[model samples]
Target: MARAVAWRLAAGLIFGISTAASAAAESFDCVIDPAIVVKVGSQVPGLLDSVIINRGDRVTAGEAIATLSSKVESATVALMTVQAGSTSEIEAQRARLDLAQNKLARVEELVKRNISAKSDLDAAIAEAEVVKRELALAEMRKRAAELELNRAQAVLEQKTIRSPITGVVIQRSLSKGEYLDQDKQLATIAQLDPLFVESFLPVSKFGSIKVGMPAMVKPNEPIAGTYEGTVKVVDSVFDAASSTFGVRVELSNAGQKLPAGHRCRVSFDGTTD
Candidate 1:
């Protein structure tokens, strides 16, 4: 597989010194290559609650692929949410503050009319200030509770694994109810759309192909589609043995109608850079 991928890469970067081939409507052997393949894994470890994806499944970016046991985390999140949602603590503090303010107001009027002493007004003012400070403290606690709830929710999200790319699931390494260790791989995914059509041309034609030039790709037996592709690479280095330059073509594979690894032939028109 690695050699095949390297050969495909060479198709785009072929460099040669010979009076090679023409850039006309000529054909060269090629192979379909996947643009990207990834082995998806998890960041944390836990018992696998479920594996929702299997081989041959089509997944979108950010789709939930699997999940770990999150019962405890869910319960914690719920508890934190309730605590964060509760406003009784702040409400009680606010009530006390209001009462203090009313007492201060009454004491001030009474003192002004000589019905109360200055010490009573002073005491009432102190009580109001204390209640105001208590209210501020209560508000801070509420904010702290809310922040904790957010943290719990974030942890819960991590317990559920999501796909990082939109692609096809080619292989799955895990099953539901299995113990998934930390950083364990769960599945392999591959992006096939806009598949790479890599091919090599004679060294002499090295200077003829230009990026963005249109070409035709003909897949071998079993794959009967003739796909249109664009020149994406033209290498300037020569392979010691083949003495040929490499050229790469990119073609659209919408709906994955064409499969990778199939042998193909690519044709380019008599257009040079």
Candidate 2:
């Protein structure tokens, strides 16, 4: 009985040591990739006037990256602007209304003095009402012109393509003078500031890793440094065949010193690769 007790104690000590060793070697293979890749395109079809950005150029969100041929659109905007700003028609109608009102007042006075026929007074009143309607019609036309100007400006704005994300341009598919369609891609951009480190962990680590946990990522030799990252995602579904679950870590690359598309290793226990 004494010998059996000693054997069980030794085996327990061996199992505890093995578990500690496995926990210490928790680093896993991972790959550094861009957080998002976008294919930039124009909203309207036109001939490309110019491409403001080239491959490898960093762009900010809402920055104009490309422009399409907009000569006709520009002219339309200018014409609409002039029409909207013109007050000649409105002023002429107001003048005509004033003359008609003065004629009606004189005719009313003549009728009161018994010098003019009632039919003459009625004619003057009808003329004044017609002029008032013409003035209103002119005012309505002016409002319509203003709305048309806004529509023309909006159509012109669609000719300029802007970047939806702040990132580096990776590819330029269309060049100046090329025909661009709404369905065609003009360029490719990748967001790298907040890089993603993707890795798969054994099923045993399912409950051990959680979102918001801190991690250390070390890229392969060419990039020699360790980056601190935070656990962004942990898969709830396991890969039955591999008995592994995927994890995503977000690493900040403020200056973008690190390039993406490299293999790396990550550890959650504050260890280096």
Candidate 3:
């Protein structure tokens, strides 16, 4: 009985040491990737007037990346602007209304003094009313012109293509003078800020790893230094064939110090490979 007890103690000690070693060596192969990749394109189809940026250029959100042929649209905006600003018709109508009102007032006074016929006064009143209506029509037309100017400006803005996000241009598909359609890609942008480190971990380590846990990422040689990352995603589902689950860690790349697409290793215990 004593010998059996000793044998069990020895086995238990060996198992404890193996468990400790496994926990210390909890590093997995990972790959650093961009947060997102976007295919940039123009909303309206037209001949590309110019591409303001090229491949490898960093761009900010809402920056104009490309412009389409907008000569016609610009001309329309100018015409509408001039029409909106012109008040000649409105001023002319106002002058006519003033003349008609003065004539009506004089006719009314003459009729009251029995100098002018009632029909004359009636004619003067009718003319005044017509002039007032004409003035109102002119004002309405002016308002319509202003609205048309806004519409033209909006259409012109659609010809300028802006970047949707702050990223680096990885590829430029369309060049200046090229015909661009909505389906055609103009550029490809990759967001490097807050890069994603992806790795697959064994199912046995599923519960051990969790979201919000701190991790250390050591990128393969040629890119020195280890980066600190935070656990962002832990897949609830496991791969049936591999018996592994996926994990994602977010590492901030301020100033773009780290380039993506590098092979890396991740340690969940806050250690480097």
Candidate 4:
């Protein structure tokens, strides 16, 4: 009887331990977020000629937003071309070549008749050759001028600024006719449509999360309903600073209702629970 009682007590203890462990292993909820703010700036510099879009305006990729006044730059390009076409040096060389050719023809005729000495004919031929070289050099100078004109035209084109990515204009720093430098931050753009909702995954959940997994986001603010997204990226390396790996979920906000930098909860279906 004593042995049986002892065995029963041990079995009850094991059952209680198993039940506690199962309760501890139950799934729970986690709030998702890796919020980031984006900025915008121009790659080149000039006077701000136009500001087409205002703050809070949504923009598409490769859309033109602002531009620098290119009138003066365009005129400079035209002037350089004119200078190349009508330079005095080129005209002078052409005239010299024409005179040398005429003189050489006359000398050759006299030499055939033996009226002009051979040495004189040779000297005239040498003068013609020198003139020909000068004409070639003049042509080379024109080619260089043409190259300069092309470069000037390219710079003039760069004055017009365009949006780098599809996003919304968050801020505008300059107005029309404002001077800007190459490194200046002209505006700020945040991708709202299909914006990325960054979140953290604990080390324990690393094996469960994978690319293409479905996710649901609930913004803290008044969004219409739960936003759907997919796991776009999973960090290969752990973030030592946070003791969590990073995961990115892409959600669309075509209506511009989901504002960037909003805190949100991300729920993974079936996989997490």
RMSD of each: 11.1, 4.1, 4.2, 7.0
For model 4, the superposed segments whose C-alpha errors exceed 4 Å read 1-38, 42-47, 60-64, 68-72, 84-106, 109-113, 177-184, 212-230, 236-243, 251-259, 263-273
Best first by TM-score, ranked? 2, 1, 3, 4
Worst 10 residues of 2 by lDDT: 18-27
TM-score pick, better of 1 and 2: 2
Q: Which prediction has the highest lDDT against the true structure?
A: 3
Model 1 — which ten-residue stretch has the worst lDDT? 15-24
Displacement of the residue 2 alpha carbon in candidate 3, Å: 20
Off by over 4 Å in 1: 1-23, 233-246, 270-273
Per-residue lDDT of candidate 2, residues 1-273 (tens digit): 999999999999999998887777569999999999999998889999999999999998899999999999999999999999999999999999999999999999999999999999999999999999999999999999999999999999999999999889999998999999989999999999999999999999889998999999999988998889999999999999999999999999998888999999999988764
TM-score winner between candidates 2 and 4: 2
lDDT of 1 by residue, 124-163 (tens): 9999999999999999999999999999999999999999
Angstrom error of the Cα, residue 247, model 1: value is 4.0
Local accuracy of candidate 4 as per-residue lDDT tens digits, 72-152: 888989898896776788789989989999999999999999999999999998999999898889888888888888898
lDDT of 1 at 175: 97
Off by over 4 Å in 3: 1-25, 97-129
TM-score to native of every candidate shown: 0.82, 0.83, 0.81, 0.65
lDDT of 3 by residue, 1-273 (tens): 999999999999999998887878679999999999999998899999999999999999999999999999999999999999999999999999999999999999999999999999999999999999999999999999999999999999999999998989999998999999989999999999989999999999979988999999999999999889999999999999999999999999999889999999999887764
Candidate 2 CA-lDDT value = 0.94
